[model samples]
Target chain A: MTYVTDVPEMAVAPAGGPPGHGAVPAADTPTQWAAAYFDGYSTVGLLAVVGVLFLTVAFVGGRLLRPVVPTPEKLLTYECGVDPVGEGWAHTQVRYYVYAFLYVIFAVDSIFLFPWATVFAEPGFGGTTLVEMFVFLGFLTVGLLYAWKKGVLEWT
Target chain B: MNDTLEVALRLLAVFVIFLVLPLVIGQTEHKVMAHMQGRLGPMYAGGFHGWAQLVADGVKFAQKEDVVPANADRRVFQLAPAVALLPYLLVLVAIPIGPDNAVGEAIDAGIFFVLAVMGVGVLGSLMAGWASANKFSLLGGLRTAAQLLAYELPMLLTAASVAMAAGTVSLPGMLDAFEWWWVPWQIVGGVVFFVAGLAELQRPPFDAPVADSEIIFGAYTEYTGLRFALFLLAEYAGIVVLSGLTAVLFLGGWHGPFADELGWLWTLLKTLALAFVVIWLRATYPRLREDQLQKLAWTVLIPLALAQIALTGVVKVAIS
Candidate 1:
């Protein structure tokens, strides 16, 4: 999957290891050309090879190691250690999840407002920044206050 | 050399990323979620704690039994899971993950556009449920639609406040200023947006569509093999996309403690940390009531989002 060497004349290094080229640096080196995990060839065309290397490594590693053992028991629907009885896919408490889901929707909206106000001092950007952020936060707040008064945030 | 070639090459790089990065992050999400819940997720997979879980999962899915219900609509059933997944995968194309101006904007309305398009994921879930030829699954899909439609509005509103404040929709430029992040004035708004994203991602406490206890895996009940894999991909991909958006819009995009050389790594680390939070929420919280979920969205989240927007406006007007 390492496409870098797969381009044209470039030879690819094996997965998890870089190309066969030594770790030699060019003349005007900036200290060192560090190879943290793996290093690839220095050719321009092989740059995207990192992606190929990445795919190959991930796929191979996953296939060779992850066990595929599935007994009749292992295939049962998760029952928290209870002996499996009916089909695992039976309908149960979806509405409860829906409630939590709705809450999550509202809660996520609240995470954005603070940072919007923090960047207000970039030269002539303060006033413009404030107006835009507020307009944005406006819709968010309305949604929240509505939910709150409606007693949605209150846990039973 | 030529613009088209460069762009094409870049797009190719992006395609490779579509494969490699998601595989890495998606597996990490599973590992993190597993650990947070006091379980070892992939401990036996790839020598080191199931590092190969996702890859194995992908392969297994590709080869495992591909079952479609005899009564199901084959074309739509197949397409639904893809629908759930494709938009999230496609949206990653325009995302500048490295922080700063490393990647220029492909579309000017980056935040707005992504937020709007992201909503399409619900449709896939909806279609999956409907096409499954199962009552439980269809209901589950509708639940997702209801949950999302309600929440997307506030999510947009919260993002709207930031886009409004930035004065431009270019995410990288907003981070280039790199002064104040979006976490302060609208802490409330940030919280809401994050919660909405959690719901959208179908994480715990809000995992209605696939609620095993209720709908027997709900909309995905009829799916097996590759289609189920696509749904899983969409789930993890959605998490990554939301994490990236959170980092960009609220946490200062690419602005880390060192916004110079380590900017790109810092942005990824931050987004990675946020993804951990999503996993954390799954570990810590219990599911809520259905009525409460909707009430929270329409009554609580939307109003708060609107108020934050209004207050932001008033404060700006007064100061200026």
Candidate 2:
């Protein structure tokens, strides 16, 4: 499908091209301009389309090649060697959620660390950057210490 | 036209990663694991050393019965394996296989892109467990979600430290950052990445989710035929992707003797060596209990990773 035209007439004005020269007059229209903007992502879009197609083919091929054999016994939920009892859903521990919460805290901290790393290496920013990062860590350390003291770190 | 050709070539590389490497690496794991256990592996499958064992296994899996449990969520059960497998292929698109052999477009945030995409496979496992309508599968699925989430923190922290030290998160950019001196500074981060990566991959010592004896293959307990094959494929592919990531992040990716002429070979060598280490860990270590696994991640690895990041920051400040 020719979703975005490749012709230069369909092209929006270059970022700083001469005012009226080579700029499509229709580019002022939102739909056309939006399509042009989206043209940049066409490659990624194509990749996704291709990926979905590939998966479809694999699943279809498996369906074609594989046999379908079903019996009541064979279709029963597996409970090791025993007969299954009750519904599959069961209460999961609350601790998993706690761990997830702790992860979020650290995850945010790590994200902040990335930009800091980039800027910290710039000239004359070293000492102040180091001190600021330590202060940030001191707060994170306090949170961690609280988690530790609360026995949230214990896996039991 | 040029962009189309690049995307096509990248898709071809993705095909090779998904289709070809798994067979070779899976066979290597089989033979290696067999030897470690004091037996010959796949000695008779193909003339040499059962080198074609994976191909044979593929055919067998292709023809086996596709059985879904009576009580299972039929649609999700069927879709879970594909969900698991596809993300790894997408991840390959962002990974540079060699110095100049990046398959997809160079993403500026390549490392983060990889970590983000890789995490989606957990959804597939969770789906598999929930859809199977089996208690063990449910338990396994829950463990996968918990374990993966827990391990991902240290893994991301360690990778962030690498990105920090290298001053870029792009795979190719990090490769460019590698110099002799950067190695010493990254050792701690490198070790953390490898360990946490192993946990993320659910390889041994961290494989509680699929502990066969305890959980009957966990999330995969009810899978049969090609569906089961897809899960196994995802796993082996995950090993390759993680190893490649480890190589790119920590080792000087595609950098070796004569790397300028044929850097892809060095990248392959490093990836295979790391994969071997993963297999070695599988053979040597006993599986940690669920609590021990969490304890190690929360207490040991996370703190060490945080400290390593601080150290990386200090060192970068000191050097610059």
Candidate 3:
């Protein structure tokens, strides 16, 4: 799963253990890479499946062991013992969504930084990528600054 | 057949850790929080310092009725616990405890995968909030969405800084690349990462989303019995993952005396030590106001994380 070697060969090799002692050698060809990619992800998928199974088993075991007695009062939405008031879906502050929108844009943009970071220090790529990233980040900063100036970042 | 057996054993090991570590953290919190507050917490439940308090709690939760609110969206409300609990388990699979691929599954883009999966975890609370059909639940849900969004950037940015510094995205690769000097070099990013990760998990100080005084457990207000317990367990599991990550990314995980033979011990000790700090913070600080929480994330953590990234780049270039 190591991508250290996957990056174009650097003059100073990236900080990976010698082959067989460190990271599993990344596949060379595209086909092998994809296979290796999914091979790893399949375990993640399996874990997710196992997680769901574990929870389901716990819940079922609870159901089998627990008592079931549902009173209307017991099932009511708890509001610190107050009887239900207006609808549960109350209108929340619109300000939250504004920040959420800002986050979405910035988050999507930052995703590019991950891969860039992996390759940023490779000898030949160092200067070029560093300048390129700051340039990219400069644009992101402008957007953040614009939002800041617009008072959109204000939480009130 | 041998390979399958090895995989099975590894999966089993991960499963055991996923189940057990949270309980360990949970019990530790019970006592640590008690001692910090000058009380002896849970001294009776399991005999020796209430060691089995969490086990007792699990039994108590199981025997209790699984209550779903009458006004709730039944299926989503019921499903929310699983959604919240599973991502941490998925993450536990990828965190390397020692060198030589000591991980449940080593994804190529390990850091990216971890951050992405953890980001998905917030949806569990959002879903719980929405489906519970309670006003407080909705508010809590909305707060979670906003806080998670606010902090996610710093978390990602800081992680990217580490990945950049290490020159790889794999967790083991990061550990393999870890130099003791990184403890000093990446300290700022490490703090920001841990703080932001805490905010992401909605742990105290950042736990406005579930403030019991204001929202009555927020997204979990309507949950009862085993369902509520699952949410609590998810939180402890989150603490373990976050601490483990902080250990690997900054603390030079498994890089102590006699590291080769005793690497896993070092990693575990570091993680537990950080987890203790987490509990200490909860005992020491009151919850922050919602606005204050957002302001800190947007104004402070994000900028610090960005600067850390730039610093890492400059330093890497200088030495290279």
Candidate 4:
């Protein structure tokens, strides 16, 4: 009984391949597809479990090892040795929100660009694919230029 | 039986990464930064070179008082450090440590998985900041979110360009693509990835989110004891993951001069080199103003990343 590596075999299996011809048996059922997908991530799942355990041990060990003597002054929020000021909640600047909005635009652009790149490298793609990508990029460039001109790009 | 073996091996690797690597890297960072500042760091801890300094620090952190602010949101505050550290571990699951020593079984979208998980760390910082009930913590958290959002674009774009060049988003596949003619063409994307990665990791020049002098350690301002140690662990873990990703994406993961049997060593060497650069940057540079960081990301790095994508497209077309 030879051991099987999971991912590469599953990835190379044609969608409708004949029974017993691939690592996965022929089953058009959604359960089979889901199982295959889950199998691919099994190692990751194991690692996640280990990771949680590692953190739990560290936190628990620290709790046991550490002293617990909390004074009221120690529990007060730190303010550069000054006495506690007003409420902890303060009005944050809107500039950070604006950066997030700008990030959203480019993030979508990147999402589109990744799939395009993967498709562009396919055997049949050529100069036409290249031109289409540039056109897509052209729209993004225009948006960026608009943002630039409006000084949204300015950190101030 | 094979599946169990594979799982056991991966668990050992994860243990090494989570438990051991951080201590070694943290020590190296202290010594390197100290040397840069013209001081001998940790010289007496392990007898000769203070190699046991990290061990001592760990024990000290373990023994310190765990404090929570009276007005703080207890649940979020308690959980933030774990949240921040968790993603770093998840990212490691997808990282190919060597040609043959990849911890987990390979996922086709390995690099994408890493980037997406890394993005989750900002939420941890945000939680820490907002739950701390400190104004400085809030500011730090918000700044962290903004900075991560700003830099993440260029980092993704640069990575996408590398993916396009290699024609594979899988970590091991990218390594296989580095046969001879690939390195020179990847130089631009590589540089962009490094610079944006620095911002993503919030290391020097780009560390405004945690500027100690400005915000008293930012989101970590109110954290004490073991929780603070966890945050520091998260940071060092972030550095290790980013450095490993850099080696995989640009410097060719596990591929170096000499024996193929020693591939993991090469990967370690490359990762340490990149991590040292990060520590060097922290030692040398002053923190950039928040606005300067934003401007650098949006105006400079983003455009350069876009241009790199265009250049990669043209070169790919021409060569094909």
Candidate 5:
């Protein structure tokens, strides 16, 4: 029954809005705001727990009803009927690690963009935020272009 | 006490939705793919067009032997499916079905929360691949990680465009702030998000990670019985989440005629329609080669997503 309000919208009161109509009141303590914020996440965590319980139930049910006979062949790692060669932990291509490094850089950039996106078009903060973001993105674009020129983005 | 009861009931409802929607999508895929390929898919399973086909499959899988490969890292192999399956369930909790208090839990930063949680799902396949102790599974896992790295940028960028246009990161807030024009405005972001989402889920065309022809089902090569079925369920659940998100972020979430009363129906309709498109894509296109897959994400989708963000910024400033 409790509505979870958008924190950013409430925290940054619009330029000319009167207090107590829809804008958050000063009387609301930060702790109350923090609790309300985490209440939503706690629900997410609870749902995740429920999901795990559901899968656990299904697996338990399967364990009760299904056979568990394990012959030597049955338990063998499958490699088209032949025994698995060498180790399962083979040395993979280094290209994947490069992609991962790129992902980390851009992923951080993307995270910064989320809050910027939320606040970018606000009443007092429109043009300035837009120019700032484009500058940030300009730097990122250079990095991406560098990767492309170096053939690091190429999968092969 | 009252709040506890309310939370309990909401969790229960979301749990029911989490269990039901994926099976429905799975059955729809079977029938749709069957008809598209000119074959009657599972006509007799539930006595009418295989209505209960997935249910029957569930029972059959439960009855089969639960095989854990001798070489597998037993705990990680067992836990991977749960890791894959739960993130979708968590994302579903934040998705609003209708206007005004209709979501399971309305997070403040709903867009960021969903994107972050969804990214964790990919690690499940990676874990499965590493733990399976099969060469193919390892390859599949590595490929999944690489594909995720390539595609996640576009997905994040596209979703960011919608958040910027709406001027909020919350899903319900985005819907509340929705205008009819955003459909055209965010169309490119919508397409990129959906395609990247499909690729993230390892659906066909971007399913080089799991292309059975080459890698023998990839990270799932060593799984059987209910364990294997859990992975399949994760895939379908991913489809439902992706479709639901695309509907909310792009087409408009639960906005239509008589939306006050019929909002949830509109949301459901849009989600299912997108799910059909997902199946249609699988039936239509051949899987891309691994290089092509990475190229599509980095070269095409990422650039397009960035442009869409710039366009969103321009539009936002112009209209204001």
Candidate 6:
């Protein structure tokens, strides 16, 4: 092992070693651009750009040309504009929101759980995934238990 | 030239299904629901139960005045319709509408990819809801988010089980795996996925987003004219999308009972059958209470889904 060595620059290395093996040869700027841009064809990058251009035109064209006539009655808020009484929008109980938030966490947990179950049964994967799943379940259970203890699970 | 022409034709076919079919389904749904309820839905719009209803509706929507509230955010409000329409179109990118599940040779990962795309539609609704500046609209948006969170899991779990039993994720691969049918292996997931799909699409019993009695048309309270119409179209189209998704995900899409050939007719029949069920459910069931809905999803549906996942894993292991 060479413990103390200075790295050589690409300008200093000689080319071509074993045939059939890929060699780390110096790349030109334009060639690199061609490969990356064209999928090594003519201009693969142009397609993506063209797609974006088309999308932009569609969006802008629709927005610009869409017939819009601003009138008084048309501008009012919908649903007959019922006045929100009693502390208005902000005064509603937070319980529903909390339930939804907790449900989201648990639901997402279950989503991942399904895929984990599938991979868990394979030869090499079953054990690791099983352990991971149980641990993951532990956190979810804690959340469920927290909700249960708080009586958030019970509906009036 | 030939390849390009083929692609153009394929795209035209896709547009016909994606853009055009929703209008047909919308009309058919109205007629069927009307007949079911012992009423003539629309006999005047064109010929026989308003065959030309969609054309009239489209023109009316286009000509209607565009409305924007003084308090509403212009950018998000304007972006909402386009945003909502995009995801439906995007899912078409991965969806296998016809026999081959054709995305240049369907991959094994089609189900998961479509599921991911389905989640994005709610984002547009949320944007619409928030931008409207009305509390009702805001609440509607939140409900949409919550509704999706509730159902998306069961649907994913159901698909995962099907994938496990089929041992592949590709639509065609799943088809090949179970040349007979893909339904029996995932009946539990199918029921769950269907109900979850209803919630995902905001159908009855899960129509909290548009619970007209309580929230006054929910997320779209502020929209008018072409914008409102697009959202309306999106809703019905969304139902078609959901129906199609449920069919493909569970019922062995394009795989009819007859000898092993799947054509456009088979796809249309299967999708319509599922769409009929959606309309039937809407006709039959009352909307679910939000709390009850969340409870059902969390306590019952999710646990049941877990047991299913466990059962699937165990059964597969045993069989293997």
Among residues 3 or more apart in sequence or in different chains, the pairs in candidate 2 whose N, CA or C atoms overlap within 3 Å are: none
lDDT of 3 by residue, B41-72 (tens): 99888689989999999999999999898889
**DockQ comparisons of all candidates to the true complex:** 0.06, 0.40, 0.50, 0.49, 0.51, 0.15
Candidate 2 residues B84-162, lDDT tens each?
A: 9878877877777666545454665677778888889778899999999889898888889888877888888888888
lDDT of 6: 0.67
Candidates 5 and 6: which is better by lDDT? Answer: 5
Q: Per-residue CA lDDT of candidate 2, range A122-148, in tens?
A: 788879988987898788788888988
- What lDDT is reached at residue B181 by model 6? 39
Question: Candidate 5 has which clashing residue pairs, if any?
Answer: none
In model 3, state the lDDT of residue B227. 91
The C-alpha lDDT values of all candidates are 0.63, 0.79, 0.86, 0.81, 0.88, 0.67
**By summed lDDT, which 10 consecutive residues of candidate 1 chain B come out lowest?**
B100-109
Q: Can you rank all candidates by lDDT, best first? A: 5, 3, 4, 2, 6, 1
Worst 10 residues of 4 chain B by lDDT: B98-107
Question: CA lDDT of B271 in candidate 6?
Answer: 81
Candidate topping DockQ: 5
Q: How do the residues B1-320 of candidate 1 rate in per-residue lDDT, one tens digit apiece?
A: 56446555755655665666667777776777776777777777778877888778777876665565655677898778767766775566556756433542244445655775688877888888777766667668777876776677678777766654554555654555435735687677778888888887777878876788877887887777766877887787788888888877777766766667777787688778888888777778887656667767766776777777776565555554
lDDT of 6 by residue, B173-280 (tens): 665555443466677778888888888888897898889899988888888777787787777778777877776767766676551455545656778898889889
In order of TM-score, best first, we have 5, 3, 4, 2, 6, 1
Global CA lDDT computed for model 4:
0.81
- Model 5, B247-318: lDDT tens per residue? 999999899999999999999999999999999999999999989988898889988998899899988987
Candidate 6 chain B least-lDDT 10 residues:
B99-108
Docking class of 5: medium
By summed lDDT, the worst window of 10 consecutive residues in model 6 chain A runs over A1-10
